[model samples]
Target chain A: MTPPDRRRRALLLAGLSVAGLPLAAWALKPVRERPRLIIVGGGFGGAACARQLRYLMPAADITLVEPRAQFFTGPSTNAALASVCAEGDIVRGPAALEALGIRWIREAATALDPVARRLRLASGTVLDADRVVLSPGVAMRWDRIAGLDATTSERMPHAWLGDAQVSRLRERIESLRDGATIAISAPANPYRCPPGPYERASLLAWRLSARRLKRCKILLLDAKDDFTKRALFQVGWDTLYPGMVEWVPHAKGGEVLEVDARRNTLRLQNGSRLRVDLASVVPPQRAADIAVAGDLVDESGWCPVNPASFESTRHAGIHVIGDACIAQPMPKSAFSANSQAKLVALAIAAQFAGGPAPVPRLVNTCYSLLAPDYGISVGGLYGVVSDRLSTLNDGMSPLGAARELRAREAAYAHEWYEQITRDTFG
Target chain B: MHRLAVLALACLLLATPTTRAQDSLSLSCAVCHGARNAPSTVPSFYGMSTAQIESALRDFRSGAREGTAMPRLAKAMSDDEIRALAYEFGAPVR
Candidate 1:
């Protein structure tokens, strides 16, 4: 071909290519849209999910919707109950997510549209996606604690995972006379932080016994017969401050029937009531607001999810994890939430983008306070089987360890706390 | 022929990106420690107990340990990832 004619032809071809760009882009779009995975409630579960999703699927469109600007984990707040501090000590907001290029917002998820696959936020922002991972932590089940609503909670602190309520409770504890009794009522199962009430009681009793010579008492009213870490907690309680802490299980006169915050009195199911100085009723909880409104929960008021992927059974493309979902053989600790979140994130990445998820292994470690020097812990390595999680009982706790072993485990517990915080936060 | 060749190149460019790669790291303790997995001279993955591994990790993170690759490497990992690697290799039974 002639040089001039060829140059002219090349220019024409380039213009045609530029003109076809929009049409070609439109044609390349998938018939069914690329599934957008939306993670709700930016706690351990949501954060872990987003982090792993970013790592696994860099190109997949991922958006995380959490109401809170920052996250203060329950891990550190378990210690805040002893000291005179507020949420400021425990609350480290969601800067971790921003580092991973995950988008976050400070608004609650008000509603969910499962069929339409869109999550509606409190501020009227609609997040439409293919899969929604809901880990709204837990919401208070008002029925468990009578006469205690949001306003009543301010006076009678639940402080399930925050620092303020714990600080307020500590202040109440300190101002009271030595002979006065401080009451801690543990609401039903599935509260935000299970090991919290015992840790608080232990820390308070540690101070009370040291300062007041066994004058102050912590009457722990538990709804369940047993707790996360029982024998170790009891042993530490007995060794540190015997008779300073008295636990009343639900079988006893411990089931909290009613509460009058103004009077500082508690009524039990057995028709006996007592007046106390400090009242903390950790109420029963549900799956935030969105999970319930979305009809994702079973009759038990908790979301049932596939244990492996944490995918909600109620809704396809929706994965419920962390405290909101019913994770049996596992307490709703931050460690459990973070572990499950990573699994769900990987599962979704594989489902939508055809990658293999690593064989899922999970871990849960919870540390409780016994004079802070004597820490009590319960943990286990877990594996998913038959689509259910089974705790590897072999390597968890050396069953019925000696006192020295327990104390050493306690030290490891402290180390575990600091290490896990850095792991999740940084 | 040139137009046909350019069209062929465009099709190849549009293929899906499906290559998953993970950063793999391994320690060869033979020279410094000893070889053949036992590492009798220094320390092996199996030689260190759980408590020992946990202590090393804690010290590494805390800057308490003497300068070494194990301490330095342990410091860089998150508890999640540390436990993960520990879960993979720690408590190795001889």
Candidate 2:
């Protein structure tokens, strides 16, 4: 071979090796090279945030912590009890998370050490991360109700979260024969699932109307002067099972003072004793004793958060969202919690990127199943105001329209649920 | 050549204003609500009452109104922006 030919071959080989260098480095690079983000509760909020995180910032690592293997969203959960919708319709798997490379811890978080930025899990494994999100939904304040606790919930079934308690209430509805008087006792504001009790009543009515339409009446006792979707609930009641549901607002001594779940009776603030075949009880709610015990909540039993980022006011690097956080104008719904999760995720991303948090756009929609084909919904947008969340005016459709409108809304309501479930765990 | 193309793309991105996050969103209000014949879907904001804006903001903020992404975007705007945007959006063009 000539000298020039050998020299050209050597230069070609050097160029080829230089080209292969980047490919070798890329092949050897680790998958989890980016920053790690740990999100608690893979329900609407956590899951949505995780999903949106992929769109906004795909390079970050997100780990979602949830005790449940599958998520059952509340958006369409009310329809399950009413027989208007099926439970499977609301249940969604981890396909959405898997797409975004979101790792999962299949257990609840027992404790959080914000200072160390470590999340202690129930399985004794520890998750140490750059950011920790706690969206552990809301728990009942049993102390507010003199005789009710977690055990009592087993019998009465808040059924707000649509789990074991939800099925328990449905079973009770099935067992009760004609002319059975069922009482739905509701807790005060900031409770998880604000429209849950009414939705349960609607479903129970759906069951009753199937067999004995006019024979049974479900009395809904409330602690608020008026309630979420009151007009919608009223319209549905009027159309589906007229005179079958009685709604007592808070002003009329509707605030629950005591409950005897064993006997299926309610003791109101007044000296009134009401006996019923089945009583579904929703006790007052505060932050989970976990956050409160850990000094996460303020005096109001809720963790105050900067609505924009959902970051803890008392602690940095820790974000609180879902029903446990104080969102004044935003109702403590699963949708609201899910939206807050995305905002928090962005805020965490901004922090990781060493930049100020980009203001977020949050959305929420609540659908109620009034009858088999009747549904009503209210959806809105949310914003951060003075370190808290407030709703934009006229963002939601007024609930409880005319009979025809209610039924039409119900059809749309099912679609809304399916869309939200996809947004969460789809 | 690839590196130069990448550099060119980056420069283009740098050249394009990243549109101010919030306050600047109002700049487009003129495009929609300004002098041109407003589309049917576009509601007239010119000469709109403040009470009307407050009412509208309340609806957008809370999800009482439906069918648009306005609530989420409107909620993010400060009350002052809502007021200012309302006034500016409502102002009659000279």
Candidate 3:
């Protein structure tokens, strides 16, 4: 056994013996065995939770169930679209979890019985745990958008979920002609990364401008009238891209009602239709399928979690974090997921120890790149007030900040990306 | 080195249950300043006197010091909480 594991075992044995528990309690009771923690999903939320749990509760048996061999972070994928960084830069092997003594089960979770504390894997293996953490970031709602399905994704890549789709979208942008038009459809609220579509549009405009494709323009169709950091993005687009971008809000023929992938056309809710050379459709999203299958989600398509402990209100002993849970005032970003993961880790430890979980004051900072060096950010500190997630104090980058401040924010964004990845994956 | 790393990591990871006034404020301060995993790069709250940390927080809460997030976080913290955090994080790492 590793040194840490040995120390944990010693501590457990000592505690059991010092309590003077009966033989039945120590030997006969199955629940009294080392508390097993099954973490579903290995994205930022799952991976970071696993590592933190292993660190804080060494005696707990932690197993992470993730289907993917590597995690591709969507936080900085816009930089990849602009060719500022290679697609590989955002992808990382999740094998580092083993260093923290976390057992990784490379399989998809098919079923979860919260009442029985049982989880079933795709390979037909059933594992029981004392507590389970559901961190399956998000499941793309393909059914919400008509004429859009997995097959349609080949032509009109959403590129919002994984690395492969992101590369496909980049390829579509690269092959565009000088006069070719590209359109991006932004989804409704409560999706992963609120400002992501705008960031992608800004970066694509930068690339098209750099290539001197003056006639090629980007058409951003939004499902919402206003977006997170809309003013900041508008200022950046006007200053940097000039007349190369057009944004249409939902009230003005922006909400996409249907997509004719065969003709590369979009039918908006406002009775408008347009054909484009390339289309990036970000559909409405919901919690992962496993969360839904376990009956953990509500009619809102998101899981309601107690902001203090992130415990699913629908079920007990199942804590949901990251994008899967509704942590309002906390955007579904990598930083928020990491912050929430830490909170979940501690709450679980306190739960098993029969101690009260302290209220967490979480923070989230989201950065968007206007150029390679020019960036803007919006951030806030979140805490629980009267059972709802409340923003203590929040602000965004001044729209009129100097170029140097934007550059510094851009650098800080990169630094944050590096730090969060290390904290999560390593 | 390992012990220091563990302490830093612990500061970041697990939130100590707040039994006293200072403990609660220290946990809040750890949110942005540093923690077991996402340690702060701004400045070390460790190895400082309670007086020093308290002065900084008071200045931030009152806008005596120019800042952004700190001022708001400090504003939410009571004077007693700030004094408690000062003493909590002030002790030198063993």
| Candidate 1: tens digits of C-alpha lDDT, residues A346-393 | 677666553455556555656565765665556555666677877644
Candidate 3 lDDT over A1-426, as tens digits, reads 235655675677678888886443333222344789999989888988898889778988999999899756888888887787888889965689987889999999999997877999999999987789999979888888899998896789888777588888888888887998899989998999999999999989889888889798899999899999899899898999888889999889799989999999999988878999999998899999999988999999999999988999999889999999999988998778878888888887776665556667676778888888888888777788888989877777787888987887777677667667776786
Which numbered prediction scores highest in lDDT against the true structure?
Answer: 3
| Model 1 vs. true fold: TM | 0.75
The residue-level lDDT of candidate 2 at A7 comes to: 68
Best by TM-score: 3
Q: Considering only chain A, what is the TM-score of each predicted structure? A: 0.87, 0.86, 0.92
Clashes of 1: 6
Which tens-of-lDDT digit does each residue in A1-426 have in candidate 2?
A: 235644665665567687775334333222233766787777766776677666556777778887787655666565665555566666675555876677877877888877767778888998777667777777677788767888877988777764777567666776888888988888778787778888878878887888764688788888888888787678778877788999887778877788887887788876688998888877787887557645689988899887777888888877888888888777888767766776676666555555556665565667667676776666665565565566654334455345665556565665455445645665
Model 2 quality (TM-score): 0.76
TM-score of chain B of 3: 0.59
lDDT scores in order: 0.68, 0.69, 0.81
Weakest ten-residue segment in model 1 chain B by summed lDDT: B23-32
Q: What is the lDDT of residue A266 in candidate 1?
A: 87
Best by DockQ: 3
Q: In angstroms, what RMSD does candidate 3 have relative to the true structure?
A: 7.3
